[model samples]
Target: MTGRKVIGLREAVAAHVRPGATVYLGNFGAQLFAVGHEIIRQRRTGLHLVIGSGGILLDQLLGAGVLASATFGHCWSPVGPGPTWNFRRAAESGERPVTLYELSLGLLTAALTAGAWDVPFMPVPGLPGTGYTDENWPNGRTSRVDSVFGAADVVAAIVPDVAFVHVDQADADGNGVIPGPLGETLVAAQAARAVVLVAEEVVDTGTARRAGIAVPGLLTSAVVHRPGAVAPDGAIGRYERDVAAYERYVARAATPDGFADWLAGHVTGGRDA
Candidate 1:
């Protein structure tokens, strides 16, 4: 545990974070949003985030003016990162919206490819009423990703600048394996430049020692131990969405102030007086 082996939270974040850099993220069970918010709370720089299928954390940042711009697929579903289509409509119409750059219409998985590859356009067919699409954005989806050359940047979907992911377990090398197939976490890690992992427990390295990883070891910049990262009220582990909480949030989403109120009650830590 000596030199360059274990690092602090601040050092880990500062290592990969730069102003104007786009970020990808993963969620733990219930405390994910809190960790993301803590980073924002610590850093003074304005961060632009590109979320895949996101959740309340992104919305909170947007509402707080912490995020300069955001692009994502599904963030409005009652579940985590809700439905991208719903967020798109709100953003385009300037209703309950923040400044957002559009990715082609698809899933959060697609957005990662767009930013990592830096593609001007992505073709996605069957976009409800919109039909197939191409967009000059850092977010979009279509058929299976076929490297960035044919599309543009074969490395386009090759990891973002700073990826924040929360997992159940990881080793000291920052090598992690998800409990199971997660939402958009593993994909985000694969496409990010440097990743900061938040794990409940840092375990021994076993199969994780095998390299040729989907998210290579070098790609992992740091690991923080903080359990209960997401929120049981919003996301139901790897099972289902928090139905009741989501139903309440849609109404609160009508205004930033309302969203803040919700956060104050549940997520945000502050004096109640």
Candidate 2:
């Protein structure tokens, strides 16, 4: 675990993240809200985001007009199971004009699997009558492949330019511990061209080893020591989700002007230390 570079969050984002990059923010529930906010504050734009569960974090990025397109399972507040107004606004008004590709959790995982395996596509169970099977629905993300068994639906590989995964603990060498269910985070990390591990705590190599590394250091491009990195979303064994904050955001960001003001108050002109 020696020689692994640990940098500040702003430096990490500035060095690796670029405009129009395909980025994956990890963990289905423990989403990286801090990184999303940093991307906004830095005014990085035209990103194509890939998220397992596009929670309020994704909604914030969409609201900030920082994303050009997004591939996600769904977008909503898991707290109230409330609607993400910004996402709804974009979809309904088309004012921001973001291309959205929605997928079932199963299909999204399959796509990541394909990317991880460096395969053209991965066969998944057919969705029968869903729009996924429609040739033009997700715009060529799915196709039918015939085998001796029968015809099967397949999803194209989704490789991100860089993936930002929040971990409970990470060493300077980039080894990370992800407590609880991995969801698609591990595979997405493997599929990404580069990987950034943002940790709640930075420990020594021995501590990281004892914790059991879910993401190996070799796959990591950089490690960022960021406590409360997933604030509002919560990290396993560290903190609880701020449900009130989620509710407050939903209430305040109900309109375009409201969201603009909210962003200014919370994210705009914010300095990264």
Clashes of each: 31, 0
lDDT of 1 at 267: 44
The TM-scores of all predictions, comma-separated, are 0.66, 0.93
lDDT score, residue 167, model 1? 64
lDDT values, one for every candidate:
0.55, 0.87
Which 10-residue window in model 2 sums to the lowest lDDT?
Answer: 264-273
Checking candidate 2 for backbone clashes, the offending pairs are none
Model 1 Cα lDDT, one tens digit per residue, 1-273: 222434665566666667667766564233366456665655535666766545555656665556656765435555553443334444667454345654432445555655555664334433433423344333332343456555332212334677887665667787766654466566567667678876655666775554222344566777776555555433334334456666576667666566667656654453210
Locate the minimum summed-lDDT window of 10 residues in model 1. 150-159
